[model samples]
Target: MKVGVVLPVFNQEPQYIFECIQSLQNQTFRQFKLAIVIDGANAETVNAVYEASQVLTIPFQIINRTENQGIAYTLNEGFSYLTDCPYLTWVSSDNRHYPEFLQALVKTMDSTPKEIVLVYSLYHRINEEGINVSNSEEMHQFMTSLMRRPKEQIYSVCFLGASFLFRRQAFEKAGGYRNKFPIAQDHDFWMRILQHGDIYFLEKYLMEYRVNGKYSLTTLTPSEDLILESMRSSIDNRKTIQDIPKVSVLLTSYNQCKYIDHAIESVLNQTFTNFHLIAVDDGSTDGTQEIIYQKKDSRLIGLFLNHRGKAHALNAGLEFCLGEYVLELDGDDWLDPQTLDIMVREMDKQPPNVGLTYANRKLWNQVGEKLIEGPIIPGLNYGDKYDVLSNLQTHCPRLYRKSALKSIGGWKRFIDGQPAILDDFLMFLDLAEKYDFHWINGALYHQRRHEKNITLIQQEEISSEIQKIVHAKIKEWGNEYIPEFIFNEGSLVKVDLRPRGLS
Candidate 1:
């Protein structure tokens, strides 16, 4: 029933050491033992730590090593001496805890269900002079936000802070801290330990975390490469266990870093939560892949590939989808909060022959810093093969049956050695041929028309490609006559699909 505390000391200041040990001596919970592992500190510092430990009335041990091992090794060495205790925790030499820290953490641990193996609390940030660096209310709010994250997202951020207590059983099961991530050892440990059992967060400031200290790890800047590698390891170690979701949103991005986050957040915050978001980055040089990898949602699966066209990227994402329905979303555009909820409900009411559902879109013309609202482009509630072939506007936010998409082989990669300029339109044509289409009436999609928009930049090429695709599909449908367009001031006013001789 006792808590085993491990204090690993290395080149710490005498004053901080005294304060750290004093805090332990003043703890309200008395059934705890301390193990101080001095890792190759100079004689002066070692003597200071030993002298400071004299105030402890509880059982204590000081294990001094001649050679300096890393924190991970030193911590493991300290814990090896506390095998008799049931609960385990570790502390730094510079941090001081409140008198109620041990009592509150132990009480929570004792009352938690058997599955909860760890409990961590929020802490206040202090300067080198032991003064609060941030407003207490603001700091509490910030730390609480981090601790409120989903358990599956623990790998993304180390919200455990400086105050934590864990069962020795869980610590042993996690195999102790790792030396691979010397700089991010704590984060790596949290990620591994999560696999054993759930963790509880106590919403109290139980300790003072010293920031900007001379010898603090917070002052040491870990390389971006190291941080990214650590994140990759965390993601690889995550075990996803869930039943198949109702919808799979395939989001493809290429050099769209500025708008990718908005697109992703839109999907993640949807009213409908029964969907997995598969984000595919097509070798973007603008750090788009990094943004995707940093997302902390368990429902998000990020894929990074070599530079590929949109068609290829969509096909790549389709390979991993495990949903009954699939929605192909553009990385630059975003859907309304109720987009999935409304679409899923509508699709559920449809018959088996209906393979696709689309909603209206609101256009935002981005000129400089302004986003000029344009007209609402309505969607055809029901479209046949002829309606899809003649309409110039590509429908927005299209949801398709996964089986139907798989039946037509995801997306068409190349047509006449050219990547499909209108990938969505081409796919719509393919779907229109076999399955019926349903459309929702609301403008649930936001389409941003910027200077870099693919449709605007390659207008002529897209038009030409569309003409060729339409011609081939018509011929394949055994039609002898090709459709002609009647234009008014360069805009298509009507489509003449009658025979050429009759026209």
Candidate 2:
């Protein structure tokens, strides 16, 4: 069977296009054709791809469109030229694949059933300097966590895109990508295909996704209104799923009298209905307790106890949690209306091994002057402990399996030093070792960066002490049980993580 690699390019940097083509040229599995579609691309990018393909002696075809149609349109047009290929695989022009990518994917496809319409392998993101900047362990944990659900249940988990190899028929059935979603078009396509059949994940790194450079297509032109509307519409669509996995919303708060009402309102306003809100008061000295008491929603349950730190507070909240899935929301931070609904739906479609799911979170700074968008590292697969340890810059609100959290013994309390500093970080490390995880591409949570928060109060000293503890534990527990933790000059450490089931 033949494999056709479809790369859609438009207004990309020349250097990125060249590097992307070069990776394909060096592929160890050589029997494939490269279809390069330049969507309203400039002369420089079109010429660069053409030159690289010629120099590498690889069979390639280029399709240049007269109008600057978007990526979705360009890719649909690229598929029009496929010449009797048995399979169709897509790679972004700004991304590069490993030499053995095709060989591995073909092997997995041959072993799996034909009805499994989509196949995706693990992938990493590289900085402009070609340095690796993704967390494979976290990605593995995230993906496996989602995968653990049921073979057919993954439709509720996530929509696999880009680094995926798909049957041409499945691609066509999914309607060849919708034009309505200029920003989240890939997500829309995956959701459509998942409704038909199952998706498979090959637990191996197959591609190098370039990030952090000025020349990347990942950067979009500044259109504030469009961006917001796109985000809103995406959430709306994600919430319209039936038979979604049950979710438990975990809220941790202490003395948030002023903002407690707003936080509660956020949870109550969620569009996804099959969820319970578990709030731990954590010994609030302020009137936060009264506000929670006054509220009367069956889904909202409050645990009012003396100060036991954030870790214990979460553990307390978990006791009251009855949902099959769990989401930890800081009392000070609120989620968009469809956050739980969308994420839970994504988690439901994953296989039984995928234990946790997370999504990018938008930032609402306390100043309220400007809203900041988080980095896009969702759907990034981190399958190793060392890689997870190194990619510390990317983090956001996440969801977890209730059983998976319990399997890790809830959150760990520092036996020796400051408990507040690296507690959440430490908890994530332990939970990651036992369960698989993945990140939803959408921003579901709205994080508020307030000066008075516990994270800011004890982050430096506490994180410093926790790093020493977690690093030492990794050595003590063996690499598999302890995800890799690397320390920098700052107390913050990068975690390298892998799927727990891997050897």
Candidate 3:
């Protein structure tokens, strides 16, 4: 298939523009054309692209608009010149594609049915310091869900501008770009096309999205609230929920009926909506099952089984999870109304290597009074496996990547040649080695402490469970794992209980 790769450029660093073009030219698939739209970019950026194209011996066309038009106009202009090509793809002038980027996307689209109008793969990030990082699973999960959805709602979430490939026919039917919104023009175009057809996702890393560039959204749009408001508007205008991100909330509970409603309420109250509530009552003799059944929401998937353990309960819930992503919520804990929406947004922005985006959690008292006012840990960042291992000793509400969990065989059913518990820790450890972790640094999840909760107690057996999981993780990561870290004394730092509202 013939491919037309269009790049819309504003002013970009000379070196980055050159590197991006070089990466594209070296792509494994050679039957492609590069359409460079110098959308009023500086002479340095245009010259860089030309120099790289010549050195690589890759033929390219430079479409220079006399005036500085926005990316939307540039994209439309570029597509106008590419009417002859069968397949169309685009990337930001600052972004780089992997060698197999086009090959994987083309192969997936070609093999899939004709109904699929768009094909998008995963992507990573490179910081301004040139350090490479992976996007979170939260992003992958959202894209995966969009791929499965009916056309309408899919576009609202997965319309990432540069990292997508589409057929020329579908592109035209979608009516090209909306030049109105300078920032989210891609979002507008994707929404319009969802009226026409379906989308497909390939679970592969195909590109590197530069997050730390001076011209990136982080700089252009500095207000966090404004970014969120834009997201809210996008969700509000979506017409249907056919392909909404399916969430399987794996609630592992022993017997906390008093707090179950709070957790369930938090989920049911999410403005983003559309999810399955899988509350695995871990052999709860309390009225927890009754409370769940009384909810009467069709989305609630209630499973009642004998008391095996938390690990067993989670695994059972996993078996029942039809959603693209799973969040393990303890029966006594809860989340904010925008928890899923915010977390999913970050996930959509992350690359494939990031298996999860977990924010900090808050501690609440029995009466639902706020206690600790901050995250369990402060200032956590994504993309380091080592940090994940150290923090797994104490963390909560980490939304795990469904595929990564499956690849690790769904939480080790056993440990140390014996039946094991704390399977969640084991699962996190396994994933930490292969995939990176993104920490949101907010208290979206609310953890409660009371007499009925197992987490409230300090047991020797619990420590043993943690140690067993740590050793198992060591076996997997080998030298890559940290040495000389133990749970007992100074090996790990312990948190001191303090008055409410104080850190």
lDDT winner among the candidates? 1
What would the per-residue lDDT of candidate 2 be over residues 383-426, giving only the tens digit for each residue?
Answer: 74344444543355678888888887887765565465556656
lDDT of 1 by residue, 362-457 (tens): 998878778799988999754568777877556888899999998888799888887777788788888888999998999999998898888667
* Residue pair clashes in candidate 1: none
Instruction: For residue 251, give model 3's deviation from the true position in Å.
Output: 23
CA deviation > 4 Å runs, candidate 1: 223-230, 239-261, 269-296, 300-332, 335-363, 367-503
Give Cα-based local distance difference scores for all models: 0.83, 0.69, 0.69
In terms of lDDT, model 1 sits at: 0.83
Ranking by lDDT: 1, 2, 3
Q: What does candidate 3 score in Cα RMSD to the true structure?
A: 20.2
lDDT tens readout by residue for model 3, 284-354: 78788667645645455566667777777787777656566777788888887888888777877888877
Off by over 4 Å in 2: 56-58, 135-161, 221-503
